[model samples]
Each structure stands twice: as structure tokens, then as C-alpha cells.
Target chain A: MKRLKKVGLIAVVCLSLVACQGGVPKEALELSPESLQQRQTQTRRFDTNNEAKLLTSGAQVLQDLGFTVEDSETKLGMIAASKDRDATETGQVVGAILLAILTKQAQAIDDKQKISVSLITRPISAKETLVRVTFQRVVWNTRGQVSKTEPLDDPKLYQDFFAKLSESVFLTANEI
Target chain B: MTNTVKKTACAALVVLLLAGCQTDSRDQVLATSESQVALRSIQSRVFDTTDKAKTQRTIIATLQDLGFVIDKADATLGTVSATKLNGYAMRMTVSVRDHGTKQTLVRASAQYNQTAIEDPLPYQQFFTALEKAMFLTAHDAD
Candidate 1:
């Protein structure tokens, strides 16, 4: 019985140490001014003459990507849309919770993850328009609290959007 | 046997309590001087329209115009929150209160990531665009 008690004490100490571990990395949560500047400049610009045409194509691209348009203004050269996706399967959530209990490390499963897109179109010149797109992801745990937000920095994602926008612009111009 | 179990449980509880005492490092980031400046720069606006519902719709439209996704809008609470992505994540919250029969008070706060945005350019630009939206909304009504 004494031996069992010692083992239990050791286990408790180990569990407590593990539980004290931070879930998110320190770097992931902090943003410096220099990093912010670098990120701000990471935008895709499309060459087009008609702002209205660009807006229409941009809206279509968002729709094709499974985003629902929340608001759009042609004059303002802005379009906002969002898409919600399930981040974890039901089985994964159950397993994670069980593991969390044993490990004492909180395993936060963001069940509902949201991706929001904001597009801005501007006329650089009489015959040139520039389009910039920004994508943000909001992660929410099962408790519906925002866990984290990540700026989508994948270049390919931006390329894909621009490619579709280019196609839509061609189609729109052809229609005119 | 019971006493042994009780002592083990107590020790575990104490450890857990100590772990909880550790402060989250994220709080340190917000305490920085830059973050404080950003927090102090939040701005508000007032609208001439008396219709609260109409004002709310206009606010939603305005945020959408700026490429913000409306996260939550509560008419009863007179609050609306929206998020946008530039190079970073930006979240904006607008609170609307009825000033009187013909006026409404609107206050807007913006944050970049977890810290408040101290730059006036973004806020000014947003409110400027919002002014246009309000004009357009009024024009559409007529």
C-alpha cells in the first residue's frame, strides 16, 4: 500500500508538470510592427480597367470558393464574404477529450472554423485597376470562443484566386 | 488506504493550483507600449438617422464595404462586430445607442490581432467609407 501511494504521488507530480505546459506557442500569439508591415504588403494585384467588372469577377471567385457574400459595394471597391467549415470530426473530438483528461494538457478542438475574405478594388489609372484580396481564418472551440486567428499567407491560395479572377474578367469583358 | 488516497489527492490539487497561478505570456504582449498607444486611438461616430434598425443595416453594409465579415450583430444590444483581413487580422466592434428621437450615437473600436490599432489611417478610412455608405443607403431609400 505504501509503494502504491508513492507511485501515485509521482504520477500526480508528472501530470501537474504536463498540465502547466502552454498550449499555444509564444511566437504564434505575438506580432511585431516589422512583421505586420511585411504581412500588409503581401497582397495580389490584378490589372484591369473597369472597377465594376473586377468587382463582379471577384464576387464570382469568392462564390466558386464556397464563400457566401455578406456585403458588396461596387463604388467602394469592397467585397466581404465568409465560409464556415468543420475543423474536426466527431470521433476526433471524443478522442482528443479523452487524451486531454489523461495528459492534463488541454486539447482545444475548434469545431467551427471560419474563413473570411475581403477584396478591395481600386483604379490605379484611367485604364488600370488594382485588386487586393485578404483572407483571415477564425478558429472557435466547441465552447464557441475564438481560439485564434491566422492570416492566410499561402501564395498559391492568392494565385488561385487571381487565376479565377482573370478568367471571370475575360468572360465578363467578352459579354460586354 | 483511505488516508493514503486523501493525501495523494491533496498533493495533486496543490500542484494544479500552482500551475493555474502562472500568468499567460500573451498578457505581456498587450502590456507593451505600442499596444497601449493603439488601444487609446479607438474612435467613434454619430449618425443623423433616427431609425435604429436602418442605422444597424447601414453599419453592416458599411463594414461589408470595407471587406469585413460580420461576425455578430445584436440589435437589442446595439452592438456589431466584424473581422477583416489585410496583411493581418483586424476586428472592429461598433456600438450604437439612441441619442434621442432623431439622432444615434455610434462608437467604433478596432484591433489588430490581439492589440488595439493605434493608427488613425485605418479608422479614418473606415469612417470615410461609412459616410459614403450612409449616403448611398439614404439615396436608395429615396
Candidate 2:
């Protein structure tokens, strides 16, 4: 009887181990730095002139919206500023610009939003030569109206915003 | 026959199995699979059409409708080109490569903007849309 119980326990443990491993897929594994670098070497560069033109077009689309251009600059990348109220309202303007240019969905602007964005280089230890763009967008709502701002620390959101603004400004500058 | 001994043996077995499964190129295999699937989906749907001019029109129109300003739309070297709207300096290029057979490779790439140095979200979306468009076009039924 004791041997039977021991065998039963062993079988149970083995079944549990098999279950755990079966759930993990071989394709989901992460890669090492060396291999990642190897892949990066094959990365191709897209056309810069065409990229610049796209940014310019995006800037024009923003102007067509209701927001007035408070400030606009296009150098290497691009930055355009338009204000409606305080920081929050300005965020909505940015959000509205993003929505208009991105999804074509009209989103209301609020007055309590705060956002900040920054771009920097990788800290040396890792793989290929890559640039990092960071953004922070905060939104507040009261009485059915909402406001937003940029410069948030969210990498994903920041990346999207950076791409849109960059392409728009780049293309716009080239057009002129 | 103690519980500790059984558990230890099981743990050791698990470790050995895991160790055996490890490979230097495992990551590469997975990455290649994901990229291949993405590439295949894009190639299959975007360039599967017979009307080259109509394909170009659809691509430009869809991009423009998505708030991307058309910088230049040209059909050359079996490719279609367009730029983004207003302030984001992103561009999309669609290329069709014919290698003798009826198979075509449609590659759509959007810019990876570094200027603003603040955000890259817009450019990523632009790229995603380009890829998605290509995939949709290639996979469309005849």
C-alpha cells in the first residue's frame, strides 16, 4: 500500500511537470544581444526624401482642423504648437491633432492635461545603434469635457506621437 | 522514499530537460518565424491583384484617407510611393518584385523618424498601416 501511494505521488508530480512545460512555446523565447545585433545588420534604410514629404503633409492636415498654430518649427525633425487653454486644453489639442491625423476620430480636448516628451540615445550596454523617444500624456475630465497633455513616460504612446509629428513636420518642410 | 527526495528528483529532471531544449539560435528561429509570417501576409494580399494601376490608386487613396498627405504618388519600378500628412515626416513605399513566376513580393516600409526626438508613435502607426494595407491587398481574394 505504501509503494502504491509513492507511485501515485510520482505519477502526479510527473503529470504536473509535463503540464507546465507543455504550456510554454519554443517560439516565445527571447534572443541574446549578439544574435539581435546580427539581425540588425540586415536592416534596410528607407528613403529620406519621401519620409520628409510625409511629415509636411501631416502638418497641413493639422492646420485644417480648428486649432490655431501657436508655434511651428521644422528643422531635422519637427515640432508644432497650438494652444486652446491651459496645459490640459493644450493636451486635448495635441490629442485632437493625433486623432484627426491618425484615426480621423474627433476627440474632445480638456484643460487639465499634462504631457512631456523626450528623445535620447541608448545607454551603451546593449545591441545596435538605436534612438529612443519617450512621451508622457495625461488627461483629466470634469463635467463631460476632457483635456490632455504630452511628454508622458510611456514608450509606446510616445513612439506613436513622435512618429506622427516627425513625419508631418519633415514632409511639410520639404514641401516648402 | 521521502517527499524531499521525490521533489528534488523531479526538479532536477525539469532542469535537465530545460537545459537540453536551449539552443543558441532558438531566438532567431522564433523571430524569423514572426517576421516571416508578417512578411508572407503582407506579400500575399497586397500584390495579388492583376490591375497594377488600380492597386496604386487604392493604396494612395487609403493612405490619404487616413490623414496621410500624399507627397508623391508614382508607379515606377513596379512600386507605389506616398508621404504622410502635415507635421509627421513619415513616408510609405510599396514595391512589387517579380521573380519570373506569378509570385510578387510587396514590401511597404514607413519612416523611423528621429527628429522630434520626443515621440515615435505616429511613425510606428504609419508603418503599421502601411504593412496592414499591404497585407490586406495581397490576401484579397481574386
Best by TM-score: 1
Instruction: Name the best candidate (by DockQ).
Output: 1
What docking tier does model 2 reach? Answer: incorrect
Q: Per-residue lDDT for A49-131 in model 2, tens only? A: 34334335445544543334332222222223332434445665776788878887666555454332222211122322222
lDDT per residue as tens, model 1, A9-62:
776676666563223222222333444343334344455577787888788888
Q: Candidate 1, chain A: TM-score? A: 0.65
Candidate 1 lDDT, B25-122, residue by residue in tens? 66655454445444444365667787766566667656654556556666677777778654456778887777667667676777776555555556
Each model's DockQ? Answer: 0.08, 0.02
RMSD of 2: 18.6
lDDT of candidate model 1 versus the reference: 0.64
Candidate 2 chain A lDDT trough over 10 residues, lowest sum:
A21-30
Report the Cα RMSD per candidate: 12.0, 18.6
Give TM-scores for every candidate, taking all chains together and pairing residue i with residue i: 0.47, 0.26
Off by over 4 Å in 2: A1-176, B2-4, B16-21, B25-43, B46-96, B99-104, B107-142
